[model samples]
Target: MPQLILSPWFFILVVSWVIFLTIIPSKVMNFYFNNEPETASTHKPKTHAWDWTWH
Candidate 1:
C-alpha cells in the first residue's frame, strides 16, 4: 500500500488525471461556447431537378 502510493508510476497517474480533469473540460467548454454558429449564407445552393443531367 505505502509502496504503491510512493511509486513513480502512481505519481504520474495521479498527475495525469489531475491535468485531464482540470484542462480537458475547460478546453471542451471553450470550444463549445466559442464555436461559430452556422448561417444560411454558408449553405450550399439547392440542386435544380435538371442539374443532375449529364452536361
Candidate 2:
C-alpha cells in the first residue's frame, strides 16, 4: 500500500538497509584483511639510501 510505503518505519528500515549495505561490507572486509597476522619476513627491508642513478 502507498500508506505503508510512505510510513516512517518503512523509511527507517530502508535507510538502515542502505547504511548496512554500504558500510558493513567494507568494515567486514577491512577487519578480515587488515587484521591478518604479520611476520617480520613479510616486511621489505628499509632502504637507507636512495640511488639517484638510473639503470
Candidate 3:
C-alpha cells in the first residue's frame, strides 16, 4: 500500500473538493425541486386515476 504524505496544501485541496462535492448535490436538489412541482401536476391525473381509492 502506498501512503501519501499529508501537507497543508493537501488539506486545503481535500477541503475544497469536499465543499465542491457538497455544492453539486445542493444545486441538483434545488433544480430538482424547482422543476418537479411544475411537472408534477401533469402526472397527477395518471397517478391519481389509476388508484381506485381516489375515485
Model 1 TM-score, 2 decimals: 0.44
Tens-digit lDDT track of model 3 for 25-51: 887766544434443354444443365
On a 0 to 100 scale, what is the lDDT of residue 38 in model 1?
A: 72
What lDDT score goes with residue 48 in model 3? 39
lDDT, candidate 2, residue 53? 93
Candidate 3 residue runs with Cα over 4 Å from true position: 1-6, 31-55
Candidate 2 per-residue lDDT over residues 1-55, each given as its tens digit = 7665657887898999999999998888766455668666876877787788977
Q: Candidate 1 at 46: error in angstroms?
A: 24
List the global CA lDDT of all models. Answer: 0.80, 0.80, 0.69
| Per-candidate alpha-carbon RMSD to the true structure | 6.0, 7.7, 9.1
Clashes of each: 0, 0, 0
Q: Lowest lDDT 10-mer window, candidate 2?
A: 31-40
Candidate 3 TM-score, true structure as reference: 0.37
Clashing pairs in 3: none
Error of 2 at 35 (Å): 9.5
* Cα lDDT, model 3, residue 7: 70
Give per-residue lDDT, candidate 3, residue 36: 41
Per-residue alpha-carbon lDDT of candidate 1 for residues 1-55, written as tens digits (9 for 90 to 100): 7665667987898999999999988888766555578766876888866565665
- Arranged by TM-score, best first: 1, 2, 3
Runs in model 1 deviating more than 4 A are 1-6, 33-55
